[model samples]
Target chain A: MNPPNIIFIVFDTLRRDICSIYGGDVKTPNIEEFLKDSNIFPRAVSSSPWTVPSHMSFFTGLYAREHGVHEDLEHGDGRVLDKIYEYNGDNIISYLKQKGYLTIGYSTNPWLSPGTGFDRNFSSFTFFSSEYMNLEEMNAVNEYKRYGKNRYEAAKNLILSGNFQEFLKYYRIHKRIIKRKREVGYPFIKGSDLIFDHIMNSSYEEPFFIFINLMESHEPSALWELDIDDRKIKYLDLSGREIISEKKMERTRNGYKRSLEILDFQFGRLIKYLKKMKLYDNTMIIVTSDHGQALKEKRKIPYYGHGNFLYDEIIEVPLIIKFNNNVKINIKNWNQSLVNIPEQIKNSIEGSMDDYMTSEYVFSESFGPVHDFETLIKEGILPSDINFSLMNEKMFYPKKAVYWKNYKLVLNGLTGELDEFTENGKSQDPNEKKEIVENLKEQIYIFKGQESFRV
Target chain B: MTQEIRIEGGLSLNAKVAIAKIVINDAIDRFKRPFVVWSAGKDSMVVLHLVRNVAEERHMDMLPALFIDHGQHYEETIEMLDKISKEWNFKVIYARNEDALSAVKGNKIYLKDLNKENQEEAKKIAQPGEILKDENGEYFEYSLETSVGNHILKTIAMNNAIKRYRIDALFTGIRWDENPARSWEVFISPRENPPHVRVHPILPFTERNIWEYTFKNNLPIHPLYYQGYRSIDGKYDSKKTSDKPAWEQDLEHTKERAGRSQDKEGMMEKLRRFGYM
Candidate 1:
């Protein structure tokens, strides 16, 4: 048989427990239906707590420490393309492209845009900004950037070039987008309607690789075209600068549920379209997340975002894969790391199913706050008086979590302290399993190439 | 400190600078807590300058410089460090092994008087009979030539700083063209004992490239490099190679680190394995 077409879908910032299939209250009907023939990995761990590193791990099959494309105190987002370019010839995209696959990419996340080197070997890559999905807004953003973010300069240049009509058109679209946002939170982000419409309109050859990153379940909750603006939920609720009222949080949670409902509807539509096109059975669809988000759940500290901590609510993501061929494949209920996504794809291409998503040891790493929070404070985006000392102590440390069997250990590299040692997700004394702890610690050292100093 | 061959010689200085900036930017992005291992030497100065450029572009303050204060550095070196760091607005954190420094008596360091931690480290890296005796019992010469001395004074100090500061990445100035041991190293290398990654941003640069970058960027030059010494280390172990200035000397055929004789006869590989740069 020929190689099957691959469709890797990333549900950005999606938590496993929130899904209905994972025994949560949120209704993900489409995903539950997809799970009938697919393998659902309930214990899959992301390699990093944020976007760039975790996605790089998926593409390179290496941890953040090994790949070295993560965030630090000095850098949060830009200039990462230079580092990503180093893996151009060795990444999964290039590998599959070399194997005669028509590689295409669609990322709604700004970090995975073409400017960031995420489109290295793709035949065509398109970045659909959540706010700039309309052609007019995209043209306006491009023009603003062309003039170095100077609106007046962009207008002057456009008018000078005899493109005054185009300038007016861009202005009208920009105003419409902003007005829509002000009137009803965010528009068209949750359903991914634009992306799905694009996909339905485009035709593809056989044995192709399509990578899609949807930001529906991400932030703003898209507020359901609700008048309630959940945009400040990220800055105010996440940073704990202003505690969200219980009623407001309940409304936010409901908005999130509605967002999921919208996403599920879109997903169902995609599935139906694929089957209508007679392509559902021939496509290998893999759905996973780079990392999960924290909604201010009970914890040692008030955590609200994904990148600062390695809590289960942030690192544990869903890994569901529907392979093309139907075979009685044994699903090992072992820990799986997102770093093995590349190997799983390769195995699928080679017609292998055994041990495809199984691993004895899974690891996840975090390097402090992925965003430049200090700069935010300096720029008054965050309150300067808010004390970051305690938060920094908790969030700024380099942490690594190792999952072996039913035990998990999260070690803090800064203090050489065990931030967490649990069995089956409950706190446990590490001394009772000293051997396992030592072995896992040695595994970390070896993975970091520091085994020579393991005592 | 000595280089035998110039293997990666074809890249233009601009290309080398671009690659080094990429490496530096990646390290700044990947590691939570990072420091530049600045020794106030030419190669390290280039590394510091490159890191500063990236940090400035990113609107980040310069990473603190970890100066391995072995208590044997040149006065001019210290003066240059003080002046330049003040002018450039970066912190210089001295990584000194206080236990070993305080135990020094004239030219000999009493090994028995060191703390138990320092003694254990010295015992692990020291060769048999290398620890001699003076009027005090079981002492080693306060010299950087011995593997044991270098380990106790510099490596131990640096490692302690790493543990103390919880440094996850250290930007060092080791180049591929510097020595055979470092020739195999990549842009980012992980180290043990204290467990941190070494970010070698200038690994592809040769001695000539270092000078060219220094001159083109107008980086601060060590006074001794102008006085015919190609490589400057602790004043006790360094010497002048020729009467001519460093750049005027025969760079292609002559040894770049001829003045620094600590890395002699396969000693650098051993020192490097024991956490010496």
Candidate 2:
């Protein structure tokens, strides 16, 4: 008997709410259709808020404490890789490869490319350059310069010019110049297209494990065919410019929405191709994200991003597992960690794994400081010098958490407060913070074997 | 008058800092030939980072670490081990119990494997002036080959490597708080045997302390912690429960019973019945 083939897909920085299946506003029909027959984990929490560590955890099944590649700092030396391997030990790819599986990985995130030890287990791994920007033929840099200053006007001008390619070029260039200036040096390549081609062409001789990471949802949103003017928007917030007009923000959001729609369409096509090729049935397909992207929400803090803090927007992601055989499981009101996916896959293949637990407790860590730190410093509960790194040295707490049964805990690092919420997303009484804090403190003190520290 | 108070139990901030600094310093001092008993968990990663930092501080010696791999581990454990080893130049030794067990099964009966006949014979021989001896009337001579089985037994086991290197001292990044077995462990201890000593430089450290240290020092750590894992032990528990036999669950049990946990004794007995001890 042959081992089962595995197809793992990670949409980079995709928020859970954006998926139609997760009760978001986006019209992700393809994703919704995929989820209908698949095992969807509605409450899958990411291992980390960033690409490097989160992806590492996905492969190794060990937390950052065990595998040791927690930060995105480029040590500029090869020693960092050595440390990662020492902690993670053997990777799943190598194990699968040893078991006669062909492993391949493709990613658009530069951080997860070959140099990062992510390539260690895969027989073949490829990272597409960010230069290609999008499927549109326009260069990202030029597009930004043309329309980024005044998005509405620029978009209007491109529309009037009646050149869709010019509009795409403007959008790509604006996106590239605005946020990812460092990547401008690299050439562009259409990663999604490359991946689609690979999937269609790869040999299925041995059981194959293919990992694909797409960065279409990453910030500085770019889209080629949004029904909006590119010239009327103002993109340069860096030049001491006035605040971006509401119209521009709206257009940006609209463009992002349109891009997501396009991605969904492409995904549908890929799925259709897989089914047509008769490879969709036996494959154990996993769809998830490294982490969710923050779309500028005020969670006591007025900004949106993942690396500097932990929040539901950043850590909570949609996890969908679909097998060739139709097996239906409705996992409601259950909080599952993404780390359990590998074990679940094994269980599915071998029929000898534990059932998903009910009273599961999830843990998370962040090395970088968040708004909670500022709050703590302001209240004199923590010293000003107690930054993210400093706090991480002294404590281990998730930035945001949802319990298996909906007893949620959100630790605001900046405020030094742990807020409790009901499973229905209702906030608990403020008085309950004290008890939660006390329990958390006790757990920390006991877990660390330190009896001297009192809360 | 000055209080002249002697601080007991709780460590001061300065003391904590000093201890942390010493950990870093000691790690740096042995940067050239640092080897960690990598268990693919959090404590071990802390140990790995200390060694990395030490090697970086020296700017001359390249520290290579090693992990004695037990065969039965989670998939993530192996992934992390391979990932970290590739990134940090750590040498991994994946030891297999099957081979070791096969090698020693033919010649000897480990205490756990003693059959009823052997038990009765040993009991009879111990009687006053009964002359305790093997069936051949000679002193019982047990060898590794005879006891463990020749097919599985190797001359030099993974445990023996530490002794063979004449290691100045072996460092383990074990924290007392996480496990009851380690809660009372001291920072450093002399091994009962020569040429090997056990050191827990991070014993006094907390999870937060390690994270803070790594963050402040801009040290690298595994990312899974950020996702929601408290520590790196791969065994996922449905709930935090104490399931071990009462006697085997605490230090007092080991002290009372010749260095064996009651759970271990039970396991040994089971293995003995199966002739695999």
Candidate 3:
């Protein structure tokens, strides 16, 4: 009868195909067990296949156009919070806080910080801190705590250094390396560990909203820790020569599976902890992922990245909700979106059918890391590796895709090609399926989010 | 030939300069020799200076600007115009009612038609609050049809000048806030049917913009402006009559053209309709 305590969990980069609950080959018994009384969504796609912009949509109920937080690889300049303030005014966290929920955030994502306006309205917010958990990097820990200010101050320093362009160029050149090094100090804490700590230590009031992003199941090669990866994550010039032997590939696959099992175990622990506190009966659980992993499957080149692509392996992920208190609402076996979960939860709280949202289509976009084509070409990257014509037409071709029923149309803004796909990511013959293709293209063109952005 | 120049506009001093240059360039291209109606006021002076600058920049012929000598201007105003004309080397058409010009030039044959005694009486300058009386303190009924009214004579001289120069276009520094009739005017407007066009380069500029641009560019404004005579015209506009003059009045509180007697008679609308700047 009372307001339910909501638990929103994001198993970062957890593929729907790999999760047993979504009928994947991998064993995720914990998620499968959680699905018994939960409403399950098999094909829930993210607004973006990455954390920052995707989470922006989740918080504000707006697409990238409305939030204006798409990745700007060209500038690589300011924080997402500065860009987001102009567009995102109404926040779901603030709404739920007004509704008398003791909101708390337990996230490992830097994108989910106060810098990005994500930590507002939360009574207590804890991060899976790199220094606090690892205890080896004290200075990095301080920088972690002062993330926004530090980044801002560093940017100011760069500008005041009187060589801002050089600084930007250097940052752009070494950004991926710096990022990889920075991830060494990233909060790589396991979800189960966080849940255990919360259960054992912190005591909050009833009807609390806990938002969690667990990063144990993030990348296949670097599944063990953010520090251990030696191989470069190739995307633009994945010339197939970067392929590891079958034995090494099997080891990487096993490492990903091991991390998945750990995530599942941790999920089970979270559920068990809730039951132990006599809170399982009253808690509402919404399960999904920020994105899915890409393990160089069904492609010409060996690519091991997610954010740069819009394939089902990158965007399509699971959505599960155990709303035991709100028994009147149950959606099953229909194509929906991970984006609608925030609004749906708000509607379920307000007990309104008129304002409740339902969507027959879901959309996704890929803002970029900005591949330097000149460097790619000079490095003797074959045209087969990445079609040069796509880059030739536009310096960067950010992709926008819309999924309706079984059909999906991916429009590459740079190349100006609208590639359509049918079920299981199979390329569709557009001439044969003329009506749906044309109707879907028109609908995409006229969509409210694409009004100003003709590309 | 008129030199071609790029036209870009913004709410800045540089943009106004660019727009002024474009207006002058466009006038040259659009007409045989376009005529600009110069009033020796701040707006007119700044725009005229801009035309001179553009001419110097492009190494093109200067604007064929015409100053309508209404025969009632102060000697000081005439001195300032002569000085500027000598500096800029622009073609100066001292357009008048022809009879007025003849009288000034002492051409007795043309001046014989004038009534000498009434002309001397009409020419006698009087101080403010002394000569004018209509029960209303301010002159407000606007008309331009009278033979003696300067509006008709100015329009006649302007039309003759347009015909003499074979000008297909005329550029005017008539700002939007001057009157209700000029408020809705666009940047480029065609008048007197086809071919004869009116180009308003600074139509979007406000009074504040004009002042700000003058100060920003260090453009020389008329000397009377500093003496609190904001709207400086030849005959009726002095610090004595209309009190401190319309220019001295708070631009926000009072209309800029309020000091001019002919505007009160609604003659400005008729003059504009007759293609008078």
RMSD of 1: 15.5
| Candidate 3, B176-255: lDDT as tens digits | 66666676677778876223678787765666667876777776677666656666665444442234433445666565
| Each model's fraction of native contacts | 0.00, 0.00, 0.00
Chain B TM-score of candidate 2 stands at: 0.52
The most accurate candidate by lDDT is 1
* lDDT, residue A442, model 2: 31
Writing each residue's lDDT as its tens digit, candidate 2 over B87-130 gives: 77645544333333332333333433444434343343222332
Candidate 1 residue pairs in backbone clash: none
Q: Lowest-scoring 10 consecutive residues by lDDT in candidate 2 chain A? A: A231-240
User: Against the true structure, what is each candidate's TM-score?
Assistant: 0.57, 0.52, 0.52
Tell me model 3's lDDT, rounded to 2 decimals: 0.61
Q: Rank the candidates by lDDT, best first.
A: 1, 3, 2
Please list the residue runs of candidate 2 whose C-alpha ends up more than 4 Å from where it truly belongs after superposition: A72-88, A133-190, A222-246, A330-333, A352-359, A369-404, A412-416, A419-423, A433-437, A440-455, B1-268, B271-277
Cα deviation of A205 in candidate 2 (Å)? 2.6
lDDT score, residue A184, model 3?
Answer: 52
Cα lDDT tens digits for candidate 1, A160-270: 888878788767776787786665335435437767889999999988999989887676653432432333345555546677676656665676666667777878888
Cα lDDT of model 3 by residue, A1-455, tens digit: 68788888888877778877766667878877777767676568888877877877777766664466766545321345577655536678888899899998888665676555678668877776422333333334344323223334445666777857745753453455446445653223344475556755777797788888877666534433233232233433343444445565565666666767777877898888787887876777888887887776765334465675777888888777777453535454446766676677886666532212335667787655434444433333323356545433432446777888777887765554674456556887888888987666644553422122332
TM for candidate 3 is 0.52
- Give the distance in Å from residue B233's predicted Cα in candidate 3 to where it truly belongs: 58
Interface RMSD of each: 9.5, 13.4, 23.8
